[model samples]
Target: MYDLIIIGAGASGLISAIVASSSGEKVLLIEKMSQAGRKLRITGKGRCNLTNTLPLKEFLKHCGSEPRFLYPAFNLFFSKELINFFEQLGLKTVEERGGRIFPQSGKAQDVFLALINEIEDSSCQVLKDTQVTSLMIENNRIVGVKAQSRTKGNKEYLAKKVILAAGGESYPLTGSQGDGIRLAKAAGHNIIPTLPSLVGLKLKDYNQERIHPSIVGFGVRNVKATISLESGKKIAEEFGELTFRENGVEGPIIITLSRQIARLLSQGERLFLNIDFKTALSEQELDEKLLSELNIRGKEDLRSVLRAFLPHELIYLAIYQTALDPRKKASFVTSQERKEILAFLKHCQFEIIGDFGYEQAIVTQGGVDLKEINPKTLESKLIKGLHFAGEVMDLDADTGGFNLQIAFSTGYLAAQNAEKED
Candidate 1:
């Protein structure tokens, strides 16, 4: 028998085991995958944006699905505590744009190594290639768990406490395939329906030419993208670079916006994305400049003249949308055609139909409902000795390291509280 059994050796489980073991508690960490921290090793494109340096108040603003539920966790162990924890483990960190913190070596493996190293050097026992099938509860009190291992076969382990850190169903290859939610459900906890968050959104009736090899990877910087309802009521707007993918739009801004867009689309809301390529110029200013450019380049072909106004990859799109003859001389261009070009540039709109789904999403938005768990202890209010941490709980945030910090804070909080359990 152990003092605690933490399932899923990802970010939360690793931290939980490290903390619980540090307090002299006998802990057993179970990981279904062959290796731990699979997703952590690939986060931030292998750089691992570990946490944000935002103050408490500012940081809370970026979280969703009951951000206040995390107040207790953050109060106990926020970004400062998290950073210090890693630094104490000999991993140097640096802050970057938007207050994102990354390992000084700019390697996600370093971050994973820091957490795993602490666990390995401690008394925490890990069971990889073992899948926890169910929570063993008697009279609404947690006893232990039932698991099956490829090498060890079926096994039952009793613990004084259990921290369900099994992640959400985002990257299935990383072993985060809704195992926590399933276990929580078996233990009589309510689960919030899960959906893909921070994924690229698909456009309705998008032109096939837009995703051509020449344009799929093109990126436009300093553009403003807005999401609005069919009634023109604005929902959200973000300003940054936008990337065109084979299926739809993506990038830092688009993925951040997808957190809300995914839910809105699922609700059958009609949404549109209006991208302003010339955010710095007013309509009249752009029109005046267009007239001047067209007049001065009268001898040039319309196709060649358009190169001055838009990226080469987008020239075909502009001409296709405006229905203008590419070979026409700039001098022969009509006022109507010029207006069309201006409209396309000023307000390029795309109807949001769907998202790229969980397979490509960075995080899962919903999980075991927060109401069923004690915010202070991360323990289930209904089941004693049963706790939750990380994406397995109903907590998600925008990019820039907010989500990872949630995992760390809640993991630390859960372990600290479990250490006090009898």
Candidate 2:
């Protein structure tokens, strides 16, 4: 029997195998896919954002909920350890904007290859096309896993200790099909409500023909996006790029707000988002600036004048929403019309009706709740020798390498702790 059996060879499983094998323990990494790291090859548009170079406290802040649960993992294998781990595997990393770390070669495949090479060098057995069907339990302890080979058809194998790094239900194409959650539930583990995270929101507006041609591929950067409830209470706010798509917004800012929006929508709450287009400018400052521009370029067409302050498509749409004519000159514009334009710019609001589903989500928000797992070992409090890591555990962070760091940290910790028991 092997010392450790890691289910799923995604980021966490791969790292766990590497760490456990390094401890001189025989490790078997099982992957249902033909190759390891199917999802890793597509991360960060194939560049593979490995980790964020931010300070520890700042990095923890990006983790929305249960950031404290990561204290032990982060202390053991933080961003610095992750960078060192890859460097030792001969995969050099470079930091980009916002301290996002990527391979110097700028290929996600290279990152995956390095991890595979490390596993190989550690004498770890890679069992590809091996789908784990269920956990093998004995006396309330996870003794092994029952897995079947996809090619061999129904042939099963058992292992000594199982680590469930099977990831959450995000990209089903990548083999994250909620099998781990199913296995965990059967083993009497509590799973949190799974929901889509880091996904794009779908708007309620039906004027797609009008909005699509105008704002597709358009992105607003360094702006504040505020989500408001039906009672006009601010739910969430973020500052980053909000990319406009034919479907809806799908950028850093939009993705960060998506989880909260999805939860609200699921609860039958009518949600609205307001973008502070010019967040850097105060209301009085913007008014003064607009009045100054008007004084210098007096009596020009209202549309032409406003075009300098907003996107042409947004200007036209705002004008339409305000019931103002774009052809009207500044001299013909009423004071109320100017006020409407300013208000719309500062608080351009839209109703969020739904999300784009799991395919577009970067990560799943909820999974096996962290409360049921020992934070230090990533082992379930309810089961002995059954460890959880990565997206499968109810831990997610905003974009910018925080999530990847968590994956590596928890995987490393789980492997180390599992090896200690061995």
Candidate 3:
């Protein structure tokens, strides 16, 4: 009988097995995928942003769904400890803009290699392509887990402790697919309904010609985006860069605010996205700048003159929205035309029709409810010896390595506490 059986070989499960087995406990790590960490191998656009360097208070602000529940986990092991853990495994890291950390080698495979190598060196046994279907419980305490494998058929592993790190519902191809939540539900845990978070949001009245595939990847930098109700009530706001997708908008800001947007949209609320391009400059300042550009380049075509203010692609959108003739000389442009152009540039609005589904989402917003689990120990309060970790819990965070840190810290804490005698 193993001392601990860890479900899923993703970020949290791997760390759980490593930490548990390193302390001379017999550990079994299971993965439904052909190889472990398939999702991890592709995170950060294939570069793998490991964790953030923000201080604890600032970092927790980025997390959602009971951020205080993670106090114990982060206190145990945070970004600094996580970095040191990887470096000790011979994986050097570097911090980039916005305090995001990545492997110095710029290879996510290297990060996976570091974890898998540590597992191979430890006493833990790993099983790939094995799906744990249920927790084997007796009198509401975890006794073991029942799993099925294509080659090995149905199997049962006996262990007093089981760490469920089966991940969230996002990226089904990576083998998450809400399996962990299913197991938790079957074990009598109340699950918060799951929603796609950090995904692209679709826009109403989408113009194929304007946001065509040609400009789908076009990004706007240093802008402020606001989401508001049809009643003009502000919902959420973000500042950074956002990229135009074929359906609507995406990127750093969009993904960070996607959870709130997705939740509101799911409730059948009318939402709109407002982009303020000239946030750094007031309306009067922007108008003065536009006047100077038009007067100085009076001989230039209005289209050519607009190039000084916006990207060539955005100029087309500006012209389409303002109904201004591109061929007109800048000097001949009327005051009304200039005002329309300025308005479109300052407050470009789009109705948010819906958001992308789980397939395109970076994380799942809900999972096992936090109240049912012990915040300090990460064990299920309803079931002794059953611990929870990673995205399987109702914990999720914004972009910039916060989510991955949650996985590592919670996994380590769950395993470290699970190995103790009852």
TM-score for predicted model 1 compared with the true structure:
0.97
Give the 10-residue window scoring lowest on summed lDDT in candidate 1.
Answer: 205-214
Give the alpha carbon lDDT tens digit for every residue of 1-422 in model 2: 88889999999999999989988888889898887899999999999999998998888888958999999999999998899889988999999999999999999999999998888888899889889998889888877787788567765455667899999889899999889888889898888878888888887772546643777777878889999998999999998888877866778888888976666677779999888888889988888777776666677888888887987867756765576877877777667877887888788778888788888889988889888999988999888889998999888888898888888898999999988887
lDDT of 3 by residue, 1-422 (tens): 98899999999998998899888998999998899998999999999999999999999998985889999999999999999999999999999999999999999999999999999999899999899999999998999999999999999999989999999999999999999999999999999989999998898866747544456788999999999999999999999899887888889899877877777888889898988888988999999999999999999999988898888878767776677899999999999989988887788888998887899999999899999999888999899899999999998998899999999999999998987753
lDDT score for candidate 3 against the true structure: 0.91
Q: Give the TM-score of candidate 2.
A: 0.93
Candidate ranking (TM-score, best to worst): 1, 3, 2
State TM-scores per candidate: 0.97, 0.93, 0.95
**What is the lDDT, from 0 to 100, of the residue 50 in candidate 2?**
92
lDDT of 3 at 309: 81
Reference-based lDDT, residue 152, model 3: 94
Candidate 1 residue lDDT tens string, 148-220: 9989899999998999999999988889999999999989999888888999988875664643467787889
Off by over 4 Å in 2: 260-262, 288-300
How does candidate 2 score on lDDT? 0.85
Candidate 1: misplaced stretches above 4 Å?
Answer: 208-211
Per-residue error for 186 in candidate 2, Å, reads 1.7
Of candidate 2, the 10-residue stretch with the lowest lDDT total is 203-212
